[model samples]
Target: MAHPRQADLAGLIDALQAEGVEFIVVGGASAVLHGALAMTQDLDVVHRLTPENVARLATVLEGLDAFVREPAQRRLRPQAAHLSSGGQLNLLTSLGPLDLLGRLHDGRGYDELLAHSEVLTDGIHQVRVVDLPTLIEIKTTAGRAKDRIVVPMLLALLRERERH
Candidate 1:
């Protein structure tokens, strides 16, 4: 199995946006976009579970040549059924690693998160990213060691954002 040597997070987001896939950037990627000094190996997103959105996401995934990044030997490709199953999928694609989540650990899905998200544009593409406070709440609630490590930094960034 060929591992993704470098993750092209921007490219991944571009691809998703191009296909009209409705998803909200979450986890470490959201923190980074919000100016937090955090490092992440994959682009984590919470996708809308509608049939139309799933179809678009599947198309993008196919274009990316995505495959399940587990049990190295099996090399499973995800289908629309899997995409709409309200589950998490960790995939390795030509562009990079991508984590497609149907819902957050705290049971917040795309609809729930959309209200707390904001759209950011870089001239060409507009990407939706979860806000700092929401991201911090997610990380804090996650209670993982890595999540905990980043909470303080995220909080500091939040404070800075508020001041400016």
Candidate 2:
């Protein structure tokens, strides 16, 4: 079955876009795009969060009463399975549990997120999405128990890519 979450991801992108949080879909959803994994619950986005990005988001979320603040904790690794704040879903800065790609690219091993993202239709709106190569990076970086279930599928496709 096509991942149900894929459909909803557009909405999440719209929400963040409305909030002025410029982010790319870079987690599980990214994996799905690259055939590295399947559906997911929470939407994982990589925001630039540069001073300008932060300021823009502040203005957008402020109107909705939704707040954007630095997520507590510093270091983040894909290997972690749970959020420190106790929730399956959350927004992260530089924290683990989101399986955020360190660097991203379109084809090859991990690089930078920008390297492996593409734009997709987010409902009526268009949004950027992470490409497959980056999805593999996130999976490798995250290295979680669940990842074991996904790795085989990714490897099968990756090996095919290597052949040519």
- RMSD values, in order shown: 1.4, 9.4
In angstroms, give how far residue 152 of model 1 lies from its true place: 0.8
Candidate 2, residues 35-135: lDDT per residue as tens digits?
55476755565555355654664453333333122343432221222222212234332111222222232322222455667776535667677665655
Poorest stretch of ten by lDDT in candidate 1: 1-10
For candidate 1, the lDDT comes to: 0.90
lDDT of each: 0.90, 0.50
Which candidate number would show the highest TM-score if scored against the true structure? 1
Q: Report lDDT (Cα) of residue 112, candidate 1.
A: 93
Q: TM-scores, in order shown? A: 0.94, 0.55
